[model samples]
Target: MHDIAPYLLQNDLGGESLVEFEHEEGWDLIVVNLARAIDRHVRHQAKIDPESYDLDLIYFSQVKEKKGSLRAYVTMPDAIINAYVDFAELMSETTCEVTGRPGLLHTKMGFVKTLHPDVAAERGFKPVD
Candidate 1:
C-alpha cells in the first residue's frame, strides 16, 4: 500500500479512508497499482480542467473479488477511469489471489480460485475444466 499511499485520499482525509479491499493478499499489489493509476489520471485531468472534473466521481466506493476477478466500484462513473478498471479486472483473472504469482483458475472441492500452480497443487486444487 505504501506504493500508492501518496495517491490515496485516505492520506488527506486521515484515519484509514482509502485503504479497503475485500480479497486475498496476493491481489494486494494489483489493487494498489490500480488505485495509483486511477488517481494519477484523475489528478492530472482535474488540474487541466478543474471546472469539468467532478470530485464525486474520482474516488472508489468498493473494491472486492467476485467470481475470481476484481470489481472496483467507483462512487460515480467516468469513461476514462472505466477503461483502467476494465483492464485491471481482466488482469486479475490470470493472477494468483494468494501469492501474487502468475496463475490460472483452479477448483478444490468445488471451491474456485485463481492461484499459482504450486499453490494450487499444494492446496489440492486442479485446473478448472
Candidate 2:
C-alpha cells in the first residue's frame, strides 16, 4: 500500500486544507473522493438486497514504510475467481458512474484481481454440498 499512501495522505491534507484546493494538480484527490462516494453508493444498494452477499468491508493498518497486504475472510456464493472479478467490475463501474470520471474504477478493478488464496478454508464459511 506504499503506492496508495501518498494519495491517502493527500486526501487527509486536502481535508485539512479548509480552502478545498479547488484546482489541484493531482487528480488522485478527486479519485479518492469518488471512491468514497462510490463505496457509499454501492453499500446502500447492497443493503437493499435480500442477502447482503456476505460482503465483509474490511480495512486495516500497518507500519507505513513497507508494502503491506490486506487479509479478508469472505465466502462468496459463486466461484472464488469469478466472484472476485465480478465484484471488482461491479465496484469499478459503480464508482465511475457515481464519479462521472474514467479510469478510477478500472484501477480499483485491477487491485481486486490480485487477491489470492481463494481456497477451501476461505470457502468453508459456506455450507458443504
Candidate 3:
C-alpha cells in the first residue's frame, strides 16, 4: 500500500482527518496523481488554508447508468467546492472509467457519485478485489 501520510501532512492536516482508504490501500497511480493535482490546484488557485478544510474522502467506484464508467469521489470543504468540481470536470477527459487509466482522450461528467462499496465493486470498479 502506498503511504499517503506524508502527502496528507503536506496539506498540514493529520491522518485522522482522512478516510481509511487514503491511508491503507494501494491506489491507482491515476488516483494518486489526481489527488496531488487537486491539492495543488486548491492550494494555488483557491488559496485556501489547508488546515481550514478537510479532505473527508477519496475513493473510486463504477457508474451504474453508464456501464464500464468509473467515478472518483473527493469530498472537501464547501469553501473550495467549485474549484474541486471544475477540476474534476476538466480532468474527466483524461481519466478512463475502466482500468483506472489516466490521460485518455474522452469527455464525460465528473461529478462524484455516492454508492455503497459492494455496489461499486460489483459494478466493476473493484479496487478492493
Best by TM-score: 1
lDDT of 3 by residue, 1-129 (tens): 135323332322334333333211112443456556656555564356556543433222221212222244444434454454445445443444333334233222543322334434454433321
Look at candidate 3 and give me any clashing residue pairs. Answer: none
Error of 1 at 74 (Å): 1.4
Off by over 4 Å in 3: 1-27, 45-66, 77-129
Lowest summed lDDT across 10 adjacent residues in model 2 is found at 60-69
Q: Write the per-residue lDDT of candidate 2 for residues 11-127, one digit (tens) a residue.
A: 222332121322112233333443354344445556787365323432211111111111212222235423443443343332322222332212131222111223212423221
**Winner on TM-score (1 vs 3):** 1
lDDT at 22 for candidate 2? Answer: 23
Worst 10 residues of 3 by lDDT: 59-68
Of 2 and 3, the candidate ahead on TM-score is 3
lDDT of 3: 0.39
RMSD (Å) per prediction: 3.0, 16.7, 10.3
Candidate 1 vs 2: which has more TM-score: 1
